[model samples]
Target: MPLNIDFQQIFLHLFNFIILALGLYLLLYRPVVAFMDKRQAHYEELDRQAAEKDAAAQQKLDAYDARLKAADEEIQRRNADANRQLEAKRQERLQRAQEQADKLVEEARKAAERERAAMLEGAKKDIAEMVVSAAGKLADKEIDPAADRALYDRFLEEAQAAQEDRP
Candidate 1:
């Protein structure tokens, strides 16, 4: 009671202050804190979903790139196979052409040999007829066909032997 000090009023005022603080904590502070916590959680969830979507998109892009690369490789492989087949066919055709050319050359050589043989036979017959005519004219008599043929054969053999002796 010194200097009009009021202990009861001070106690009452302190009690009123404590009650008000409790009311504020229940009505305003707690709800505000809970609302802030909910908003933060919502934002975090949205960010997580966005990150997941981005990852999925990136995965899809990687898959598409892989497919594109595979397609390019397949195309290259097909082209190589086609080129190889074409080359093989070309080589086969060239070989066939060479064989045909060789066959034609061989036939030509055989034909030339037959022609040479025919020419030699015809020359021998002509020479034999000339010799028979010359002998008949020198002897003033006709020559027998059989004897002329024998003499022609002997001359042909001697001519063949002489040709064989040449280098």
Candidate 2:
């Protein structure tokens, strides 16, 4: 009314603009926003699944490490047991060898003692026979002090000869 503008035409243009905005909001804008929300949800699900798979892999790694530790401990225990058994066997063999050596030494000492006893007995018999022979020869002659001395010297010579013959 003030600038000679028509009120009916202005009202018509304003109504047309409002209708176009409403149509775009319902058709293009709403569909694009819904598509973006859907894509975001899909990506979130993929991330959650990946986290679960990583947790499972970590659990498997821990299990394998535990198994390896147990295997190493078992190997050490077996080696210790084997070493102990070997040492025990070595000690037993050493003890047996010592016993055998002691037995041999004792037997040798006993044999030497028996031989010495036999030699002493043989020396006693020879001395007794020499004494009897000297007495018989002295009885056949006069036994002066000089003759007694001479007989003693002869007996000493025979005893020395017997000693030389012994082993």
Candidate 2 lDDT over residue span 81-166, tens digit each: 99999999999999999999999999999999998898889989998899899889999999699989988998999899999988
User: Candidate 1 has which clashing residue pairs, if any?
Assistant: none
Lowest lDDT 10-residue stretch of candidate 2: 1-10
| Cα lDDT, model 1, residue 132 | 80
RMSD of candidate 1 to the truth, in angstroms, is 7.8
Instruction: State how far residue 76 of model 2 sits from its true place (Å).
Output: 3.0
- TM-score for model 1? 0.57
Displacement of the residue 127 alpha carbon in candidate 2, Å: 1.7
Local distance difference test, candidate 2: 0.93
Q: Per-candidate TM vs. native? A: 0.57, 0.59
How does each model score on lDDT?
A: 0.87, 0.93
Candidate 1, residues 58-137, lDDT tens digits: the string is 99999999999999999999999999999999999999999999999999999989987987786678668766865766
